[model samples]
Target: MIKNHLSQVFYCFIITIILVFNSCKDKINSENQTKTEQTEVSKTVYASSVIPFFDQWKLILGDGSNAGIATEFENKDFFYTQNDGKDNWVVFKSPNGGDTHGTSNNTRTELAQTKKWYPKTANDKLSATLKVMNVSATGDATVAASHSVVVGQIHSADAFENEPLKIFYKKYPGHTKGSVFWHYEINTAGDDNAKRWDYSSAVWGNDFSVVGSDVSTFPEEPKEGIELGEEFSYQVVVKDGIMNLTFTSPNHETKTFTKNLLLSEYTTKSDIPEQTKKLFFPIGQDGVERSEAYAGEGCFFKLGCYNQTNGKSPEVNKNWCSGAETHGGDIQKQYADGNYAEVWFKTGSISVSDTAVSNDGYFAKND
Candidate 1:
């Protein structure tokens, strides 16, 4: 009996030791896994990657001292000027328009246009960031109508044959007060008016001129409204002619849209509007006609702006007013000339912050 009791005690001691060892091993493994995830998430583009593009332009703008002119830089080709005074905000022609624009207090530096590179052929990967800041607005505004942004290609001097892997964001301005809506359109190589597409337009065919279908799919409009003074972030990927768009709010709520497309489907010879067609090519010495004479010359990128509909009566003026009285109306147009469109190889992955606003009103690191 004594021998049996001693053996039983020994067995119990061994079982307890085994249980404790297993528990400790499990805890260590879990901790290591968590550490690995954190390291992976921290790898996003820092200020260093973005600063060089704007540095030279900032020096020319004199740190935003001038008040009446809004200067803009292209990829080293054409410069754009807009009347940026109190009530006359118009884009004019300035000799040094591509010099400098505005300075951000965060880095205390001037801001310049970030050039986007288009691949030589289809199926090439292309990515870019379009940063929009509300410089001076008393009330909260939502980005309403769908605006177009140009990617690859050179000048509108030629036919836009090479289709781009395009991606853009859609803003939903539901019924919320002070909410704004923004739409994005992506154009490939072609005449200005020929390549333009709008999100609000219906998706009919694979025509490059038709909105959404030529580049990538846009998200469904939101039923509920987003509040005013709110900031939104969008990330997009275009790989091998496949495009994907993702949207995230300050709260980290995310949504994604993906589609597969062929480059040939978008190349069509449809009858486009005279104004739209003119936008396809550069304004030459005799600035008004569609100059297919300069075909294959390459087209650069351009950014278009539109107003959103607030519940307020149409009497309430909401359109973004500018000084270029000659071509003033619904679309606020800005173009980047071709010479500056240089290509750069991106090394690591890019991760942007959910909110562009920092405590001090500057772009903050992604939270």
Candidate 2:
């Protein structure tokens, strides 16, 4: 009787073990099925669907891969579509030490317009509604380009290869809000790029000249500034060598700027702004722009996250170099430590016109 009882208990224990094993297996299968379903749902949204202009542009990811004609394409590591419950946005993410473009140390996951046109003869416009999501958190506070990203640009592809417009969003670490500024890189005379310098203009806060005293310290935050994740819109209209820029944000004052691309604003040494002299002259970058700035130059529009943070030593160029942590160029590690830049665009459009539209009352309406 004792043996039979022991046998029955052993068989019961085996049966219970098998039941528990089956239950755990079923749970694992269910979780995997749920994950598959979630992935299927996420695959429905594409970057091209968000902007609808992918066919007219070529994408260069931070990994240095050229995603040509990126329609119906998405890369979760760099370029992808993200939804914020209220709306869907196209996200451009780049690491600080990833692959970069020609001769540029900074990495970018951006869209370059395929068709190039001369600013003098062509009337083109590009507009976008975007917000900067993140910037490199580990960098010297004294560095001007330490925690910033370029969102929009009109890049010249000819004659000295300078940029006429670069919309930037910069925020120092420990600051509540960042500054919205634009830069105009001079087309240096005699094709000498080493002397090329950028003139910065602020739209909502301090310009690029604002910096901290030391590596870890930061300046006071801007009173009227745009915080991370705040929505803003920028419109760039290049009409016959004249560029008109408009920036608009909710609860903040709208700003408008007009520049003639055919004429040089910094033709002589005295034409340099005082801000440039104090900030850039120390770095030996006080070059003057050509008399005809970007005249008849082939240019195109670029929109996305052009990461300004780099791992270069700040001792070389304190203003441009951030000396940020790059983790030996490992992208995964850099991203984990906030050594990256991210920007998101909800809506964007590009149009070419034979006629120029009037921007009348642009400044007066804001005032």
TM-score of each: 0.31, 0.86
Model 2: per-residue Cα lDDT at residue 129: 97
**Cα-lDDT of candidate 1:** 0.27
Residue runs of model 1 more than 4 Å from their true location after superposition: 1-116, 119-196, 200-223, 259-367
The candidate maximizing TM-score is 2
For candidate 1, write residues 65-174 as lDDT tens digits: 22211222321212222222321111112111122232211111122212222222122222332222221111122212122111221112123322222222223223
Best by lDDT: 2
- For residue 326, give model 2's deviation from the true position in Å: 0.7
lDDT, candidates in the order shown? 0.27, 0.87
Q: Per-residue lDDT for 202 in model 2?
A: 97
Tens-digit per-residue lDDT, 1-367, candidate 2: 9999999999999999999999999999999999999999877899898889987777888887777678999898999989999999999999988677766779899888776777788789899999899999888889899899999999876656689999999999888899999998889987577878888999998899898988898889999999999999999998888899999999999999999898998989999999889888898998988898888677888899999999999998878888998888899998888999999999999986644232222212211
Residue 270 accuracy (lDDT) in model 2: 92
